[model samples]
Target: MFPAFAKYRQSFLIGLQSNLVYRMNFAVRGFFSLFHLAVVFILWGAVYSQNESIGGFSFGQTLTYFLVMLVMQFFVGAFNEDYQISEEIRSGLINQFILKPINYFSYRFSIFLAARLVTGALILIPLLVAVPLLKDYLTLPTEAWRFFLLAPAMMLSALIQFSIAYCFGMLTFWFLEIQGFVILSMAIESLLGGQMFPLDLLPAWIFNAAKFLPFYYQTYFPTAIITGRIEFAAAIQGFGIQLIWVLVLLAVNQLLWTRGLRRHTAVGG
Candidate 1:
């Protein structure tokens, strides 16, 4: 067990180094994210001009929400592994994993985790620097305890999102052309994951329904926890929901991978 753990650690380090070598690409992404945040800032500013608050959030709070949401999205929205897995399946490159002693899921997850660490750091540098400049418009959680709790919530968010993406990638075993599914999954996630806007802005019924879905836990719940939108009791409940979803998704991933592997044949070179 120790040797296997060390091997996985080595893979993670290799992935970190590999991604760092392409730091310029992530730097470009980070730049584009700033532009995206600016556009969101302007748009939200326009919306708040005529109103004091919407969905119990003031303009400053809304701005703060988006800023934090942007960073959370970076960490939780690392889904590229799905596409990579799909492409490898199509190219019959997955055979390499079958011949190795490594657990394919763990191997891929290690790489994904490392890539997120590198890209997350690049993405966060600008946000961290901008925090002081945006201090006046920022609305942080009043209860400092929620801040401490947010780390675990966000980690769960990453794992849940990664599991969802892994399941989508597993579809490649059955359908070699699963790009459409990948795009569809991303579209759904963007819409329902609170990436586009806060779930609080939605109608009560819709918001209530969304809470039951995994998407809500991906972004909105964690943001709400840190922003003090959710009370302590409610935040605990939200964390419970997040944990349950992660377990459910883990089961789904395992089942799908097992079934998919049976159907998968590395036919192409």
Candidate 2:
């Protein structure tokens, strides 16, 4: 596996270099995201002025959760990847993967991983600079053990999201236009993946249902772990559930890849 990864390693490096050239463009994009943060703070601040806590979080803790979520999104958010992958599939660029020794999924994953690193690094610049200003609102995890669990949870979240996006991208094999499908999927993810708000803020039944879905594992689980909203036992259980989702998504992606390739070969060629 190590020897095989050497090939994808080159892809990783190339992706990193290519992304580096556009650092300023990406940096500016990250800079503008602060405006969205501003709007959130104002809206939530108003809401909190009326009440001490919403969904068991004090105003400060709730804001901290959103701040942490912003950072988590920088790390694991999968956007444009579906479009990119679908474009490649539609344009027959994947023919090279079949012809070459490289695995298409591995190649794309390495590159996307590099992209996430570059994006996360760029976004952190402004965030770290703003740290002092926002210190009053942000809260760090209380226990060192939470940090330990956080690392793997973050990785699982990344894999879970990427696998789902990849599976959506691969659907290009069967459909001519996947925009509607991809958009619908994104709407669901944003609603359910704790992108809009912590799932704990939802009604009991809905929150409980989300726990069984892969969406919550994407953003909510890790953020909840860091925010101390979840107990140690719950965090450990979430870790296991997240890990299982990763495995399940991987299996599903493999199945999609197998069938997608067959469809592509028969229809495209």
Candidate 3:
């Protein structure tokens, strides 16, 4: 167990180093992230200009939700593991992994985790600095416990997102050209994952329907908890739903990987 753990640690270090070498990319992404957040603030500010609240969200609460949503997105978003995996399969690079003792999932996931760690930190610096400037627009949870509860929910959210990406990546085994599928999936996720807006702000029927999907768990549910939109008991129940989604997605990922391995072939040297 120790040796295997060490192997993953090494994989993570390699990933971290590889990503750190491209510091400019992180800077560019951080810039764009801040720009996007500003756009959200302006858009929502306009919406709340006339009203004190909408859908039970005050102006500050809505902005706070977007703030947390942006940070959550930085932590879990922009992963291209699906595209990377598809490319590996298409280029026959996956054959190299078959020759190694490492678990492909663990190795790839370690790399994914490592990249997120570096990027998340890079994004965090500006986010912290922006907090004081944006304090009036931000509405934090009054209950300290809600902040504590957010940790696990965010963890589960990351896992769910990873599993979704991994499953999509595995589709390369069957569909050699999956760029369209990847784009479509990302668009759907962005819309449904509450990256565009808080899910609760949607029509009641739409919000209820979204609960049946995993995308909401990725961004909305966790942000809602941190912003106090989700109370203690509901947050607890939401966490249970998140855990269940993780398990379900993990099973789906495993099934896809096993079946994909059977169909996968190294076409190029």
Candidate 4:
């Protein structure tokens, strides 16, 4: 197990080091994410200027909500899905990966996590430094224990998202390409998963329907916990929901991977 982990460790370190080498491009990506923050602030500010509160969210709370959402997005954003996974599957590069004793899922996931950490830290450092200065007006969570609990929750959220995404990307084994599928999935996640706006702000029926779907567990509930929008009981319920969805999807991925491997017929292999 150690040897297998060592291989993945090496891959993750390589990805981390490579991200550092291209730090300028990463900085630019961070800047682009800030545009989303700006747009949300402007759009929501207009709406709030007319109304004191909408859907139980006060003006200040809504602003803080968007800020937390934006920051969470930057922290958790993964890279282009199809290019990373589909390319390997189509080009038979994945077969090379199979030859190694290392687990393919672990290798891919570790490298991706490493890269995300490197890039996310580049953006988060400034936010951390400036957050204290803005604490007077901004209402961030004051509970240190909640912040501590958030670390593992964040990791679990990222892992669950990546597993589901990579499983879909693995469909390139049969689909031949998955760019269109990737776009559709992202669109659904944004609209149905509360990535664009608070789920509570949506229509009651729509929000109820979204609760049954795995999308809510992606960004909404976790961010809610971080923002103190959810109390202890509610947070536990949310975590349970997330855990169940992760297990279900993980099972699906296992089934898909097994089927894919059986069907895979590359020339060399």
How many residue pairs clash in model 4? Answer: 0
| Model 1 agreement with the true structure over 211-241: per-residue lDDT tens digits | 8999998888888888767788888888889
- Tens digits of lDDT, candidate 4, 29-121: 777766766687679879988988787677667667766766666566566644688788888888886776667777778877887777778
lDDT digits (tens) for residues 85-176 of candidate 2:
99998888888788888988888889889989999998898797667777888777679888888888988898888898899998998998
Q: Which stretches of candidate 2 lie over 4 Å from their true place?
A: 266-269
Worst 10 residues of 3 by lDDT: 73-82
Best by lDDT: 2
Q: What would the TM-score be for candidate 1 when compared with the true structure?
A: 0.94
The positional error of residue 173 in candidate 1, measured at the CA in angstroms, is 0.8
Q: What is the C-alpha local distance difference test score of candidate 4?
A: 0.75
Ranking by lDDT: 2, 1, 3, 4
TM-scores of all models? Answer: 0.94, 0.94, 0.94, 0.90
**Backbone collision tally, model 3:** 0
Each prediction's RMSD over C-alphas, in Å, is: 1.6, 1.7, 1.5, 2.4
Query: What is residue 188's positional error in candidate 1, in angstroms?
Result: 1.7
| Model 4: pairs clashing at backbone N, Cα or C within 3 Å | none
Better of 1 and 4 by lDDT: 1
lDDT of each: 0.84, 0.86, 0.84, 0.75
lDDT of 3 by residue, 175-262 (tens): 8788888889889898888888778878889887887789989888888888887778877878788889999999998999889989
